[model samples]
Structure formats: structure tokens, C-alpha cells
Target: AQSVAQPEDQVNVAEGNPLTVKCTYSVSGNPYLFWYVQYPNRGLQFLLKYITGDNLVKGSYGFEAEFNKSQTSFHLKKPSALVSDSALYFCAVRDIRSYIPTFGRGTSLIVHP
Candidate 1:
């Protein structure tokens, strides 16, 4: 079985400081990893994906993630946080042949001024 875990329920960061939201996964086969962001009362927006090749993948709004196969982890990162960046984030993963992806419970990112 494949699954993803987002240990933190929320992350608090200053507007100008860097931020990170942790993620870990378990899969039977090669996994397609993804990160999505959701604002209040809105659907999730695709932030990035890791299919193959590069370990470091960049995404929208200056967000990036590193795919570590050995550790079975893919953590989201940003050098500078913004007040507008405050939202909920979800980490997802799917097997190569699976159409339905499993998502983490979600992590609330609060960027303060």
C-alpha cells in the first residue's frame, strides 16, 4: 500500500523568513509525488510534481521540494515566506498505474508580519 504522512498540523513562520513543511511516504512501486496549496474556501492548486529524474523540483510561488528516494521523503521549502502565502498545504502521492492519489491530512501555514 502507498501512503503519505504530514507530521505537522501547522507551521508558523515570519513573513520574511524561510519555511518548510515536512512529508514522508511509503509506496509499493515508483511514486508520482505532488504538492498542492489551498486557500480558504477554495480547491487545491497544483504547486509541483516529482515524476522522475531531478531530485530537486521547483514549483509556483518560489516553492521547491527535494525528492529523497532512500529516505522516502519529499519536503517542501521556500527561502522567503510571505503573508500572502498563508494557506493549507497537502502532500500527495500515487503509484505509476494508480489514477487516484492519496493526500495528507494537510498542514496550515501561517505567515505572520
Candidate 2:
């Protein structure tokens, strides 16, 4: 079964500092990795994706991710953090065999102003 793992339950960062949210995935074939952010009660919003191309992929909200095939990891990164960026982040993975993505439990990011 395809699955994702978010090792951290929460990550704390100061405003203006960089932040990272780690994710690891397991799939039968080439995996489609994604990152999503949810603010309070809002739905999961797409952050970044790694379909095909350069390992380094960029997405909304000044977020970027590096897809490492060897490690089966896709770690989300931001050059600087803001208090508004504090939210619940979920990592997901899917394969051609599955139409739905398997998501990690989620990691909460707290940015202190």
C-alpha cells in the first residue's frame, strides 16, 4: 500500500527564519508527491507537487520542495517564515495504480512573531 510519513508532530520557528517540514513516502512504483496546507478549519490547499521534471519544484506561498527519489522524501522548505504561515501541513503520495493520495497524519507549524 502507498503511504506517507510525517515524522514531526509539530515544528516551531521564529518569524523571518526559514522552515522545513519533512515527509517520506512509500509506493510500488514512481510516486507522485504533494504538499498541502490547511488553515484552521479550511480545506487542504495545494502547496507544491512533484510530478515529473527537475527534482526541485516550486509552488504557492513562496514554498519549494526537493524530491529525493533515493530517500523517497519530499521536504517542503521556505526561505523565511511568517506568523501567518502557521498552519497544519500534510504530505501525500500516490501512484498510477491509485486515484486517491495517501496522506500523512500532518504536522503543525508554529511561527512566533
Candidate 3:
């Protein structure tokens, strides 16, 4: 079975500070990892993806993630956080057996002004 876990339900950070959202995954075979963001009542927007390349993958909105195969983790990171960066984030994984990816429950990132 393939699954994704976002340990945090919410992350509160002040503007101009670095932020990170934890994510861990389990899969049977090779996994395609992805990060997505969603605003209120809006569909998820792709942030980044790690297929097979460098361990560090950058994405939209100055977001980046580190893929650690041994730890089975892909944690999202940003050096500086902004008020507009506040949004709901979801981590997903697609296994070789299936095309559809399994998404995490979602972590709310509140970047206060």
C-alpha cells in the first residue's frame, strides 16, 4: 500500500521567517513525489515534483523540498516566508502500480503579518 502523512495539521509562522512542513511517505515501488498548495475553495496547484534527479527540488512561490530516500521523507522548506504564502499544503505520492496519487490530509500554513 502507498500512503502519505503530513505530521502537522497547521504551521503558524510570522512574515519574513523561514517555514517548513513535514511530510513522510510509504510506497511499494518507485514513488513520484509532489507538493501542492491550495487556497480557500480553490483546487490544488502544483508546487514541485521529485521524479528521479537531485535530492533538492525547487518549485513555485520560492518553495523547495528535500527528498530523502532512506528516511522516506520529503520536507518542504522556504528560507523566507511571506503573508501571501499562507495557504493549505498537501504532499502526495504516486507509485509505479498506480497513476493516481495519494494526498495528505493537508497542513494549513498561516503566515501572519
User: Model 3 off-target regions past 4 Å?
Assistant: none
**Clashing pairs for predicted structure model 1, backbone only:** none
Q: Tell me model 3's lDDT, rounded to 2 decimals.
A: 0.96
**Candidates 1 and 3: which is better by TM-score?**
1
Give the worst 10-residue stretch by lDDT in candidate 2. Answer: 94-103
Off by over 4 Å in 1: none
The count of backbone overlaps in candidate 2 is 0
Ranking by lDDT: 1, 3, 2
Task: Give per-residue lDDT, candidate 3, residue 81.
Answer: 98
**Candidate 2's residue-wise lDDT over 1-113, tens digit each?**
89899999999999999999999999999889999999998999999899988999999999999999999999999999999999999999999678999999999999999
Q: Write the per-residue lDDT of candidate 3 for residues 15-84, one digit (tens) a residue.
A: 9999999999999999999999999999999999999989999999899999999999999999999999
The residue ranges of model 2 lying beyond 4 angstroms of the native Cα positions read none
Query: What are the Cα lDDT values of the candidates?
Result: 0.97, 0.96, 0.96
lDDT value, candidate 2, whole model: 0.96
Which one is best on lDDT? 1
Query: Which residue pairs clash in candidate 2?
Result: none
Local error of candidate 1 at 74, Å? 0.6
